[model samples]
Target: MFLLSFPSLIPLLRAGLDLDCAESWIEEKGRPLRDFLSEYSKAAVEQGKLRESDIDNALRNQYMTLMRLGYFDNIPRYASLNETDICTDEHRSLAHDGARQGIVLLKNDGNLLPLDPEKILAVAVHGPHARAPEKVMDGDYTGPPCRYVTPRQGISKHVKISHRANTTIYLGGINLHIEREGNDREDLLLPKNQTEEILHFAKASQNPIILVILSGGGIDVSFAHKHPKIGAILWAGYPGGEGGNAIADVIFGRYNPGGRLPLTWFKNKYIQQIPMTSMEFRPVPEKGYPGRTYKFYDGPEVLYPFGYGLSYTKFHYETSTDGTSVTLPATGGHCKGLSYKPSVATTPSCQAVDVAGHACTETVSFNISVINGGGRGGAHVVLVYTAPPPEVAQAPIKQVAAFRRVFVPATSTATVPFTLNVCKAFGIVERTAYTVVPSGVSKVLVENGDSSSSVSFPVKIDFSV
Candidate 1:
């Protein structure tokens, strides 16, 4: 972090950057953190950049931080950390779990998954990215792993590293180049038409296709999602070292997928009008800036909405609500710890509720039951999305208020409880002051994999009248 203290890197550091974007991408042998700190001082003095006292202060703070982190302590926690501490069962399990749960089941058309090993016989896997996870990338910031689980280790020699389950399993995705940091990506789709390549194979093979995607962000998969030949699709993301095992477990029905997409996979045409440079948070219809995220973005319906995913087994939800609507009285005197700048408008008004203060207490709550509709007993995630107050000009179309995951048996129900604060959940940001949870009706929609149910919530402010 000594590099962060450099006057030249101040702008970048302020933008939440680390040493990665700093001028020193590498330090050939003798140049360690302290050496770099000294070098920065020399440059500052010679170039008349930073004052001597300022340089000294920065150096002092960095050194103090290192010391506090135990650099000079009698017993540093990392003093003897060796290779043995690297890949333990705990570490491997964490990696495996992350990859497993992060794997989003993008599509499982016609109930083509939870592959019936007894009937399907074998999975004919073939894809550009069907090899071991380490081969794609291992320890992106560090060295190689102690070991990695591969298809050869998991399956037999004949059942090689290829994608196309259901007899045809096609695995394809991106690498460290998710248009990541330093360099940028020009195209939304992969370097090659990996979809076309899969389609070609799908036509040649007799069986249906199962496409596994590995990438940091979503690309245009409208073709595959709608294709009659491609029956199942899974997005593994950058699953890490234990990714192979996780993929296998999902494919073979050993593990049930309850993971959801981390982002809204908008189609490629989205950028045609919506420039990447557009940083405007809200949509301006007069200006034609479409806005962004599942929160805003009006037209050009996304290929998959944020938090969209499927489970091996289907689910239906039933909610326990307080009838049609319930009114909440906002009469709690002066909301204890709340503070905000008064609205610049002459007629300024706001609900005196601090986000932190309300976050600690439950203002409203409801219960939801998740029932597994499919024959297979598996886990399901019940997503609760709340429609924001339409009165607010710059409000989201909908916001994910709460979510709960439950392991329900086949054809059985599991009740999931959700709590939310009306002021925090349905409130709108009008300028810098008033956080108006405008008194009116806001809708709360709960969804399982297949269907959704809505709950009406009408809030009334006791003090407003």
Candidate 2:
């Protein structure tokens, strides 16, 4: 029953023979085996366990598999593949594009962003990440990049080209630490010295100040968030090889930012209340669990919401639904109430069939029109969220079902259409079965940047199984 060598045993298994044999046995029994296998296959077909053509088909497939493996081994040499040249113009341009899209404008008060290069008399770049190309290039994979552009270098190049400022200052902060496996920071606050250094530069600068943050994750920035002197704040998250050029592009109005926050930027104090390991989706006051994620957390500890981001150009959203409701057959068992628990021994099933024995499905579709209200052109990411009916069992406050990124010209509009399965979004998990009792109303919200519009439709669970 044991397979000492897989390849040697494959033929025996395919021929429907189960036996344990040694390598020496194979030498004695397998060499002149064409006549033996042919007779054995003929016997197997008469016994009805296998078709007469099965043996030939299996042997042909096995031969083809071996040939494919041999062919794949020479592909690298045949194609002349080489390591990526991170320093090439093409690579750097791609890096610039990536950095531009990754940069998020968290706070831009008084229309201070997209700095006018002509009006500025002086510029100051102050941060640990200002000139550290090595730190910025240390990405998650492939170690450090071969070449990189520092924030200082990027700013200098653009400033020189525009002749925008008479002077520039570099006020350094804490050096960035490359995060490796099993090494995570204890807190989200900037180093004490770094904070002090930033404050010192902000107070000493005579002209408008720009604070550019460079790190991989969110940090507490309540002070900078409210600071009046800090004209602009850009979150340049570990810009790779061409980060410097991309930062300069955004600073000098060459590129309008369209990136949104991928994670919530929580205040430092909230970390104490919500441990990273908490798995509860809803807050448990009795157990002191604050819950997790943007779907359930209701506290004011968040500095920025999940989808919050800023842009140089403004956008407006006009959303409308088809005003139609769908009814799907209700199958599977339902919990009596929120506190009801099903027995562990019970087998759960989710087959949707009506009394007439017909499978049922429902689809929901909507449209969102995004208008570039600002004079500048930029890309907008339209987010669509669905709020389940209040009567739905154990539903999140809202869930993002669909999103689309679109480029709209200055003073132009782009219409985006989305089709989604309503059952997938609104279904409730009871025991192990995912079921939908489509009753009451569900709300759909279309959002982009700070604008949002919503529509609601009622669902009827008329058919039962």
Candidate 3:
């Protein structure tokens, strides 16, 4: 069958007649896949599996798909294709803006960040990734970036401008192959040598320690979390070409970080408890499945929670709501929380129903006012979360329903309004059915950096299946 399907192997069939084949078949070249497919189509037609007209139709469809995708004469032709012209000043500015905005300030104890570049005599930058450029790319999928900026380069440039220094110290080397298609890390902690290097620097230097971490996934930085000397932490996820400059800008107060964490950063101890193979979205108490994500995770307090990020400056939030009740569509089933037990797996439960068989809903419209209290102008992301009442079933502890990024000038306020449909916000899914069971009051929280305001509204879930 292989010889018949692969035209290049037809010669092998003739060679097989000799029966004493000793050399490897790796040297054999295969015919073009298109030519092989054409021959295969002819054979299939003779065997009655496909009609002659079917082959023509398939080829025509493929040609049409290619044409639609601009693979033929429709290709674009620009006037200039020079690399420098392609990457314009506007493009560089946008890249810089992206890098600055995406920088998440994980920790800044005692307001140690937004470092005054002029205050220090000398600054020491050391990490396996601080000077390494290879850390930016993921395997062969991405070519070497046009411009590379290591964290060290970024920090040094700004430091040179601010402070004149004769000697700079670089310490410790921690290298690991963490990015690959099928490979996974054995653990989440930093390499032992890396930790030792940090400790060595901490003990030797009298100056403030600013730690910059580069990683695609979360790392357990419990040691740094407790360390008194380490004042700041910047989680710069593989910043692209302008990463170094962006890091420098944020450090020197050129940019204010508004990026929030997309996932939870677990501590070292929690790493072993939550196995990577566990896929349950809800907590499994019996087998010790802690569950995944901030939505269902009922484990130990994480190092950094989802949507948690620090900024150099602080902001305050004021929230007000417009409505009290909403109405929802009904499903024809019992309204209850869905549970997945190994022995007794069943469909999701249903909510209470009205005489008209429509679920009761409430629309909560919020007017959130965010004021940047600090001196620096920066952007703030307003996050809105909804918590279901106790009687409600199959709901997360709290879920983010709405979010917005607003830029508020120093001492100025930005009012961002959002309308949420309570019925849709609190809906849960069973095997194949979706139901909303809001029995009591639900809390709505509007949160900004360091501050949050919440309001409670009574819920009436009345629907008929």
Best by lDDT: 1
Across 358-419, the per-residue lDDT of candidate 1 in tens digits comes to: 43243567788777777888877677787744444466678787777789998888888877
Best by the TM-score measure: 1
Assess each prediction's global lDDT (C-alpha) against the native. Answer: 0.66, 0.63, 0.64
What's the candidate order when arranged by decreasing TM-score? 1, 3, 2
Scored against the true structure, residue 454 in model 2 reaches a CA lDDT of: 34
Off by over 4 Å in 3: 1-65, 78-85, 135-144, 161-176, 329-363, 421-424, 431-440, 450-465
> What is the lDDT, from 0 to 100, of the residue 58 in candidate 2?
63
Q: Model 1, stretches more than 4 Å misplaced?
A: 1-44, 47-49, 74-78, 132-146, 151-166, 323-362, 431-436, 450-465
lDDT of 2 by residue, 10-65 (tens): 46746645332322212324562323344355666777766646676766676677
Q: Model 3, 180: alpha-carbon shift in Å?
A: 4.3
State how far residue 11 of model 3 sits from its true place (Å): 31
What's the TM-score of each model vs. the native? Answer: 0.80, 0.72, 0.75
* 50: Cα error in model 2, Å: 36
Off by over 4 Å in 2: 1-72, 76-79, 84-89, 142-146, 161-181, 331-361, 427-439, 451-464
